[model samples]
Target chain A: MVSALTCLFTPLLRAAELQSSLIASALWSGDSHNFKRQSHQFSLEPEAILRFDNRVKLTALMRLRSISFDGLAPQRVSDAAYSPLGKPLYMGNSSEFELREFYLELPSDNYYFTLGKQQVVWGKADGLKVLDIVNPQSYREFILEDFDDSRIPQWLANIETNVGEWDAQFLWIPEQSYHVLASEGGLYAPTSPLLLPQAPPVGVSVDVKAIDRPGRLLMDSDIGLRLSRFWKGWDLSLNYLYQYDNFALLYQDRSLTANGPHVTIQPQYRRTHVLGGSFSNAFDNWVLRGELAYFSDRYFLAEGLSDSDGITKGKEVSSVVGLDWTGLENTLISGQLFQSVALNRQSATVRDKSESTLSLLVNHTLLNDTLELRLIWLTNSNVGDGLMRLRVTYEWQDNLKTWASSDTFYGSEEGIFGQFDDNDRLIIGIELAFE
Target chain B: MKYPRLLSCWVGILSTPFFALTGLAQEPLSNAQATLPTGGQVAAHINSRDEGEAVSRKLSIVMRDKRGKTRKRETMSYRKYYAGEKRTVIFYLAPKNIRDTAFLTYDYNTPEREDDQWLYLPALRKVRRISAADRGDYFLGTDMTYEDIKLETRVSTADFNFKTVGNCDVDGHPGLHIEGTPKTQAIARELGYSKSLSCVDRQIWMVRQSQFWDIKGALLKTVTIANIDQIQGIWTQQNINVENHKTGHSTSLSFAEVDYQSPVPDTMFTTNAIKRGL
Candidate 1:
């Protein structure tokens, strides 16, 4: 299906006088730990926009990525008590180089249509909230390693239209795999343990299994309104989205012990809804912004579960406010506060976590346009944690940029009564982007 | 007998009172009009150098929903300029909660005409650049561009037709309103004012007010000048207000204090100064 669309769009793009080029490179680094290593990558992404005489416009992106990494073996079990009775597990480090994005878009005066694999960021993502980053989730160990290229679905179709200040979009996802949640509550966990029925030590030998189900189809529709001037000094925006997922489910009732009581679970076959609104205003030296959002509980639970019987059922509401003072030409001071809460008790069971954070950031330029520096400090009340990061970026030219960054995270949990060492990380790398 | 007659005629001419009075009246008189400078010459001098400061009051309005309910806020600020020197200070006086916040910006005006701006966040004790392109796109998100802050003094670039409309009192000072228009399309686009007209004060030769329009002739913004004053013998416009009619938001500047001839060190605009937060 992807090839067919490419074949069809290739001719159209050629006829429209479209042109594109691609470039890529790779680098590798070794760690003193022997098993840990890292790699550097470079890519040239260029797109040619062509407008046919018929007023039909076609655009395509020629994307590429270079990957290099160290070869590391998977952790081995040293004790027989915890080791699984199977062929000794042996996993090796692997890396691949490939083109990440190659897609064509057809846009008319009022509407646009895109077909092929593309990176899609559904919700507002600032490193924290990535509700719908549905491409391939990179299993890479380091965050920077995953930055080379994004995991995107093999097939996708999208249509967008704008009427006045309002915009609407519809997305279709075909042949996409939903991420399977592991029995252990971690982003990436080791393979699950298999237990026989009616085993002893329920907590100790409750075998867990990792299931790879068939891919499913998904669809989402979004509507947005632009209210830039409905008021005296405020800018407003409102958006709503509805998503339908097939073969998407949550593992609600997984028995840790064999032959344990059956855990009533929520079904997986429901729709998810999200609604949000935002406002922005600037007065003299101060700029103010705020946002309010609500997500239906159905989206957080298993698909087929009844609202009344589900273990976690309810709604979530989030609000944020920020103020920025622009007293100096290149200087700005800002403060932000945010809160999220589950409305009902049933919802609170699944979303009982609430947090508040304060952050300060400063950026300045040095050596003309050659060097730039940024410093940031963030503190969170919930974990009593604090983070500080310093980054120095140098831009050699339009195509080349490099930065050295260092970050430290420190925190302590009350009642835990233990001192914890601050986790410190340093990263230095260069990037070359071309067109 | 002829020489004697010629000598008598010369004597009678020297004694004529009317001729003597006419010579006295022809002498030049030094009055107020004679002391006043030419408007064109004054404009050239003001545009020759790029260093000044101004105070301002800004009003921002937000309108939401189909019903059109509006929210408005106002603030006061003190601004200083060193032209290409790259550093500026803005002190906010109003809004008691934000009085302590002072903004200091460092600019890197590249040869490409792209300016990189950095801001010092006092509370954060850090300096951050104006990273986002959209941050400098508008004046407080209004129609005013960043270039607007550096008023265009290039009069020769535009085909100006100056017509003294009438005499009027502006802030207690008598002033003349002259209208100017761009003569060519290319020049209009370069100035970022495709279809705009300006009113220049006849006395001080300063821009009193200007209205900008789109190519389709729709009003985009209206910039007005006020508080005309003399700072260290240099005539200056102390306040400027730019209002976007479509958005109901206005960015006004008041020059709290100014010094045109103050000596500013060249080292102040360098990249090192920006890093040191000087």
Candidate 2:
């Protein structure tokens, strides 16, 4: 399918002095847990890119993952055994394989257009908020189960135009669906149930009844405006986004009731509306950024639910503020504070819990950008827990690229009659991208 | 913004010559020797002076391809210096990612002249040396080449026939307009300005503007001196506008702030400085 289009477009690109290239890379990682259990993984990521004289570009990316773990059979091993989310998980390896990005872009003198499967980030949340953009859902994750599979629209089209000092964009998602949690053996059974520390970890189950029948096609649209200007030695940017989605209603009808070792819930459909604003400014080697978002009712609604009473109505507001200082030429220090609150609840029936997080990060470069070091300290106010992560990366162009990191989580609650000891996880990997 | 203000001031200064020579009566000289030598020397001196000083504080240059889309580049640098027995650096500054890069030229007049350059990288805490022949190449990533910033005296070795066109006000300052043309083919072809015309201020003998033309007499670039300010008794141009007639793309440099007489240590221009990280 893509070959025919490429053939048709090749002559036009050649006439326009455009260029295209393809790159393939492989990455491998090995890890040992408590100096005992060990795992090894490998992945292949291939990408093709096209560049036009007018700065227009198109890119397609594919990723394949294969992993193996010692001391455990493949059927017996699950993501829950390694982390909180009881789903199949892999860093650089996954049993599933899929396309990452298949997007086409047409950037002209004054405007740009993009259409296809792609990731769109609205705000700067890094990886610690409702809007955190740590990873986009890959094709493999679509066929498998992973907590990282949050949102990936099947069809999307976006247009951006600049008028004077203002840059505006309008995005349309004709069909969007959240990945359904794969059933362990049944057609649509919930694999892992949300369990409290006192609950049994294995046999405990959840019965999620589809009120509106889970997966329904819905339309979503977002409009954004950004104003960029320079003032007194500072570069300032202010932006706003308004989003509307129809799938919100479905997600609202879902509810979970804990009954001994079993739980049952119904998923409903609801309308979702979101409004957000952000500001970023840089002055005298200092950068300050802030963002606020308000989600109305059905922020993450699934499809097919009963909205007869419309009792499930509320709003969620999240805000984040960050500051970065670049006093040293090769070093940077940054910190961010984030808070999320559920507002205007329908009644006391809805439990409104606010989550606050603080993060501190420091980064430095060495050996002329060949080596880099990053350290992050994160604390969650609601969970009364802290996490520290340290990562070191080394790159020698096409020769070798390696990244080693360790994450330590503290204050984890006891689970299933066993104390959840602090987790000290370490990962090291190398990537080769030559030829 | 500063360049615009200085440009208006220069326009005022150049306008005076148009009125003074045509409006006021002046004695006409009959002997060619009486007017040629001094007038030619003054013309050359003015042109040389304007080219000698580095004009501009910081400039944002946008280079677009034939399709009018700007290209993204990692870095760009510009440097200028005076030519003499004792060399003096006129300007040494690179933008953003190219900062801390420096270039030095020696024996600028001779064919065997040499230029040594270096770039300091903060991440490595080291400076790397560059070859002299690279002068003709693009400076870092900008469209302007190293040769563009370094004045080539061989181009101005022509035996010039100078005639005072008139007096005019340039940026509100009074100045004279003198036209010079090469007397011999050797000088004409060497300078590449055989058919070009230059306007000079009589008092300071500073070339305020120069209009270049191709061999076929088509206009190329009209480089106008936009600002001339006095610094430590030495007149320096603070702004310049190079307008390409064909492309309609113009680059303007305005020196928002400058220190002309600042004590620049000799050690600062050494290869050691580049190695030790500028």
* Local accuracy of candidate 1 as per-residue lDDT tens digits, A1-435: 999999988876666754343333333333323424343544445545466655454545454433332221112111111112111223333332233444456666666666665554432212222233334333222122232232333346766665464455555655333322212222122221110012234343332333323323334222222222213434455645454332233344544345554443333444446577666555544656666667774333322333333344556677666666654433445666666665654442322345566666564543222356767666656556566667787656434557777655566522001111122446676765443
Q: Which stretches of candidate 2 lie over 4 Å from their true place?
A: A1-10, A16-33, A53-55, A70-94, A130-154, A179-206, A210-263, A268-270, A298-313, A347-352, A414-423, B1-278
Query: lDDT, candidate 2, residue A356?
Result: 82
Q: Model 2's CAPRI class?
A: incorrect
Candidate 2 structure quality by residue, lDDT tens digits, B1-278: 00000011111122111111222223344565344335456555654554334322333343343344442211122224545422322222222222334443332444333433333332222222223333323333332333344442112332456665545445555554555566666444433334545555567766566565433456654656656777656565666555546555444444444444454444434333332222
Models 1 onward score TM values of: 0.50, 0.50
lDDT of 2 at B149: 48
TM-score of chain B of each: 0.50, 0.57
Worst 10 residues of 2 chain B by lDDT: B1-10
Q: Per-residue lDDT of A229-316 in model 2, one digit per residue for the tens?
A: 3333233345544443322232222233454455344444444555666655544445676777777653321111333232446678
DockQ of 1: 0.02
